[model samples]
Target: MLHIRVITPASRTDEVLRIAADSPAVVNVLKLPGAAFDPEGDLVEFDVAREGANAVLADLKALGLKDTGGISVEQLDLSISTAAEAAEHAAPGDPEDAVVWEELSARTAAEARMTWSYFAFLALAVQIAAIGALLDQPILIVGAMVLGPDFGPVAAMCFGVLQRNVRLIGAAARTLAAGFAVAIAITLACAAVSRLIGWIEPTMLDDRPLTSFIIHPDRWSFVVAVLAGVAGILSMTARKSSALVGVFISVTTVPAAGNIAVAIALAHWNEVGASLVQLGVNLAGMIVAGIATLFIQRLMWSRLGRHDIAPHSPEVAAGQPTSGRVSG
Candidate 1:
């Protein structure tokens, strides 16, 4: 379930109340008239099932409350009310299966930012993977995979494509490109310094038994990437952090990136080439599969939710703002 708080102008408060009262999936409606100080208006609150949220939000948005006042939504981790249960029962589908596009957009938008912490995590992950590659330690490799944060932007890029959001796509792409470049550069510098100090050798790349697959791209790599991509997007949309961890472990992007940095530092042209190929394969597969997964999800929800929404008033039916018009 989701909790919605709205500050609507006096002129639109009736319509807002009507929207909340009309939605079968909404309950515990409360309104405080003239309570808002900034963008002063009525403060309306309600709880709506996740499966029915998109429609309610769409209608509220159509009323232009966002421009006149405001709309805020927060997830309800626990709702013990019988009314909440009834609301869920009234909803069309399971909460976990619901795809709240605005929530997704907000999440992905934040993740796609090229913040300092983003670079720090990515660079640190690459260094860890590089060290793991030199030591031929699968355990450390797995640790690096878990620590890697590249998947966030990749998934953001996928969502951007689904929404046809050019600005979002550019932001995510730039974040990915600059992040990888910075991470690779850091790892490469660390490798060069380690080589100068006799801490690593070119031969370290040659005798890996368990970790050599990082540089050897084949059909299986693409297949695993595709599977991970699907799982990753689903986890994001469903807000399942546990499933996201599995997706992280399933992709080889970070390991391959580490291999490329180490091979470049050691002047192993063949390994570097192969690792580059592995990296490309992983990225391509993930993007392709993520986009496809989002497309199918959008289609499924649009069909199931078509008849589940409350009826639109004449104002809403006049096409002020249709469904899926506002992106976060």
Candidate 2:
């Protein structure tokens, strides 16, 4: 359920009240006149079922209340609500657990930001991959996957496309490209240093079967990538962060890219080409799967009556200044 607060001029109070009263989803409405001090206006507070929140919000928006006053829609956390027990005891398709697009987008964008920790994680991932290649160990390769930080921007890109938010898409793409470039470059340099120290042998690359995990490409590779992408998205949205650790372990992009760098430095063209193919396969699979998963999720949520909320729109609340408006 959602709690909507609208501050409107006394003149339009009737119109606003009528709109709220007419909404079938609205459960209770309260009007407090002269409730605010600065730019004083009447406050109309109301509650609506979660299933009808999007529709009610849309109707309120169409009323242009923001232009005349203030309007805000806040989600009521189910945990603290007096109705929590009832809500919890409800059936599986409970409206309270319905997906909210605005919340999802905001969370996704915030998580997508590239930070120092992200770089640190990527560096560790590359190192893990290099170690795995040097030791010809599959466990090390899986560890490298678990350490990779590439999923953030990839999932962000999928969310951005679903929301049609160009800025998000651009930011996610830039982060992804920059991170891979940096990881690949660092791995290549490390490979060079390792070669100088005689830590890696050219013959080892051809003899190691485990190394094929990063270099070999097959149909199953795409299937794994797709599964990882779905899991990645679910991990983010459902706040099951630990699931992401498993997702990393399932993708080979980081390992393959790292191996490609190592192969290049060691002058192993065959392995380099093979690893490059593996990297391509993993990347393509993740993107396709991620986008498809998001689409399906959105469709399911929409069918359950959740609609997209345009947070970036310029529309204002009634009794509030339309121009120079700022959201808190």
**CA-lDDT, candidates in order:** 0.86, 0.72
RMSD of each: 3.9, 6.3
- Poorest 10 consecutive residues of model 1 by lDDT? 306-315
The sequence of per-residue lDDT tens digits that candidate 1 reaches over residues 86-116 is 8888877788998876688789999889999
Instruction: Please give the lDDT score at residue 25 for candidate 2.
Output: 53
Q: Model 1: residues >4 Å from true position, as ranges?
A: 307-328
Winning candidate number (lDDT): 1
Cα deviation in Å at residue 78, candidate 2? 7.3
Task: Report the C-alpha lDDT of model 2 over 1-328, residue by residue, as the tens digit.
Answer: 6788888888878877876665555656889998856457888888765555544555555566656677777866653544433322331244534454545666778657878888778877987887788779988888888888898889888888876779998998888878877888888888888889988877767678767667778999999999999988877766577988999989888888778788888788988888878878888888888889888876775555334343444342232222211011
